[model samples]
Target chain A: MTIKNRSRITVFILSFLVWLALTHIGDIQEVIAGLIVAFIVSMIAGKFLITTEKSEHIVKRFFSAIIYLFKFLWEMVKANFHVAYIVLNPNLPIKPGIVKIKTDLTKDSAITVLTNSITLTPGTLTVDVNPETKEIYIHWIDVLSTDVEENTKLIGGRFEKLLTEVFE
Target chain B: MIRVIGMAFILIGITFDFFGVLGLVRLPDVYNRLQAATKCVTFGSAGILFGVFILQGFNNFGFKALIGIAFIFLTSPVSAHAIARASHRSGIPLTKETVVDQYQEDNELKDN
Candidate 1:
């Protein structure tokens, strides 16, 4: 079967299995319930989530997204320590500042993920995102430089690249 | 026997947690350190919490443990991203051991 068909089939099977486990229904009943629910959800998903423009890019996008997510998870683990050390130290040796970071990403979902990710760590908050300018304003617990160019390059640049690999 | 098993898992989990702490202190860079903290603490805490849950015999405490695990998974990644971005923006230079900086071209375009 084609990948698309297989993905759908896999989704069906998985949903059926999850339903069985979650509801503790018999197999036949599980299949019926799962299929009906899956069909309804898929229809809603197609209507609300999938666009014709995206449909063509869906397969390539999905795989790439998974790769990005794994990389992102790794980065997340790393950041936790950075924040932890910052927290544990008595000096509270943070140089806090607000900076504007410019990026190439304009996709809504990706931008949201990027912004939310920024907000999750200990020392930073994503205060604003501007798509028209493709920029984000971040409040960093430490601001080592006032140079706009340097700050922009540091904040959004690396993430924009990784996120590009992941989402765009 | 059950108590022994519970103790074993909790200690194993706590050991992992300490390893995560050590990783936080010792890893050479921001990226590497996060790796140690996220995976180690996640599994460690979950292991300990699950041990507690099992020991408690699936009471409300068990439910809370599961929820705690879920919360850790969700929040950990986002927080890490935030810290990294903040560091970079603050001009906290990455270790010399590091190389690539991808957002340069894109940033240039926005400035213009």
Candidate 2:
């Protein structure tokens, strides 16, 4: 089969799985309805839904992405606690500033994941992306360091490595 | 035991949300407020939903709660990013304590 056909099928399967998980209906009619809906929706939107070029080791990448998700969640929990600590403190110690950092990931999906992960974490917000230069401007509450290399390693180090593993 | 655990989760979630509100009111600017709002709502609501899931067990209610958690996880940051970018571009200056303004420098370079 062509790559396009494969992607369409993949989208259909994914949407159908989502439908199943969301509805959780055992009725035959509901399941049939879900299948038809998922197929039609996938046919209409599949091409736009997936942007990543097809690569080898699809199964391995998929599993690794799941592991990456758990790691991301752990980071998120830690971030929440950190923010809570700062907010609850009497001094409200924050040194808000915007800092520039570089990202090497070229794929749109990888860059997106990196930014979203940063935004979701506590005390940091992704303000803008220089698409041409692949530089991200982040608003950091703590302003740990002003140096680009230090901030890059501090902000994007862990998540970037895992995302590259998943997407690249 | 299950009830106790669920109630504990709910209480903790409420506390986090309260702190989030406090931060929102106390923070100096839009960006900081967005940070407080997004992280707090995401974690707080997710925590509450989790508590509901635990309280409901693996039934329909529990499953729906899980879906709610997933939706919040996916969408909160995107919305926060959108608000932050919009405010920044529309000329929301950083607080006086801001140490660096790289975004402004980048814009100036582009303009030149």
Candidate 3:
């Protein structure tokens, strides 16, 4: 099979597994219905679902993505505690402002992951992206610095490296 | 033992949710509120769902809880981004103490 066909098959299998896990239906009729649904959905949408150019290292990418997920969970927990502390403080010491930071990631998927990671983290939100310069505008609850390099290191430093490994 | 851990998670989740609500009420503006709400739902609700999963163990209900957690994790940030972008575009003024305005600079450059 061609690489695209293989990926579509992979998508179909993954989606079918997810459907089975989610529905957990043992009835034969329901199972048959689910199989039909999963096949149809995958056939219609699989091409758009997974489109990584580097399909050779699928296993390596999957492992790194799993590790990245655990790291993301840790970051999420830390962010929660950090924001909770700031919110619960008597003075509410927030210095909200927008800062511009550059990202070296070129792919649309990588950029989306970076922005979503930033927004999900407690104290920062991605306000905009300058596609021409690959600069992201982030609204940070704590305006630590105006320096571009400093802000980039602060915001994208953790996930950007891992994401580069995963996507690029 | 699992029950104890689940209860602890539930308690922590409630505390986070309470503070999130407090932040919503006390914060100065829309952006800050988005920060609180997003974190609250992501961490707070996820924690609760996780606790439910643990309490139920490997049963069907537990699987549903896991699905709920995944759904929340995937969707919360997108909605928050939508709201933040909308508020920013509609010219919602930042809090008085905001130190910088890079977005405005970009807009000016676009206009010129």
Candidate 4:
């Protein structure tokens, strides 16, 4: 309804349309059709779109997110090697269980990134996020309780914080 | 050269798809399964797009691939978050080896 909201919606739609056009450009006719469809879909979904502009220092947050992503990627590479080793060995050394880990991030996006990044890892899975308790119930192939909070800190304090700086 | 790249992309995409499905079936937990599917599918899908680009050079196939990849990137986490939230809300006990929880601020905020 407001100019800001309308602008947000338009940007969102355009971004989506661009993505579609770029991905599906098999033919001229198809690309044109995709554009039409994207336009139609956005128009239909316009009413449902909620644009609440929260301040997240864009430049600062962008850099932070980049750093976080870099760290996460590195960690994933290492985790994969470890997981691969476990897989190759006849004895699967994975002692799996779900553990409750608390989060410290205040923003929804920050928390989302943290949990998703956790899911991205090989041995660890983000099983659940308790709304009431605000804790993450994660399933780890290998659990080490003494370092649970610390590990979460590593997740939240390190990556989540950087993500917050990027997107919050 | 273009055709070669396209073929490579297609081949790689197919392989990633295989890995994605394998991870989904073989992985023990939902989270791990999700990781495999999301990551593998994403990478595989990218390969497919690359192959398409090689063949078509930025047309409809590219658009479709990009759309699918972006949608997966945006939506996968959301669904994962929803599933995780549901599991957590339902009060499932965590694995025995978990060492720490770092979400104290969130808990305290709820208390407040």
The TM-score values for the models, in the order shown, are 0.50, 0.89, 0.90, 0.66
Candidate 4 residue-wise lDDT, A104-128, digit = tens: 6776656777777776565566766
lDDT against true structure, model 2: 0.86
Q: Residue B82 in candidate 2 has what lDDT? A: 86
lDDT of 2 by residue, A1-168 (tens): 666677788899988887877785888887999999989988898776565556788888898899988988888887788788878888989999999999999988788889989988867988888889899999999998989999999999878887887887
Question: What's the ranking of the predictions by TM-score, best on top?
Answer: 3, 2, 4, 1
Give the fraction of true interface contacts kept by model 4: 0.27
Model 4, position A36, has a per-residue lDDT of: 72
True contacts kept of 2: 0.69
Error in Å for residue A129 of model 4:
1.9
Residue A65 of model 2, lDDT score: 95
Query: In model 4, what is the error at residue A4, expressed in angstroms?
Result: 7.4
lDDT tens digits, residue span B1-112, model 2: 9999998888888888887898899888898888888888788889999999999999888888898898898788888888888988999888898888889988999899
The 10-residue segment with the lowest total lDDT in model 2 chain A: A46-55
Choose 2 or 4, whichever is better by DockQ.
2
lDDT of each: 0.61, 0.86, 0.85, 0.62
Top DockQ hit? 3
Tell me how candidate 3 scores on lDDT: 0.85
Q: What C-alpha lDDT, on a 0 to 100 scale, does residue A26 get in candidate 1? A: 49
Let me know the TM-score candidate 1 reaches against the reference structure: 0.50
Candidate 4 CAPRI assessment class: acceptable
Interface RMSD of each: 10.1, 1.6, 1.4, 4.7
- What DockQ, between 0 and 1, does each candidate earn? 0.08, 0.68, 0.72, 0.26
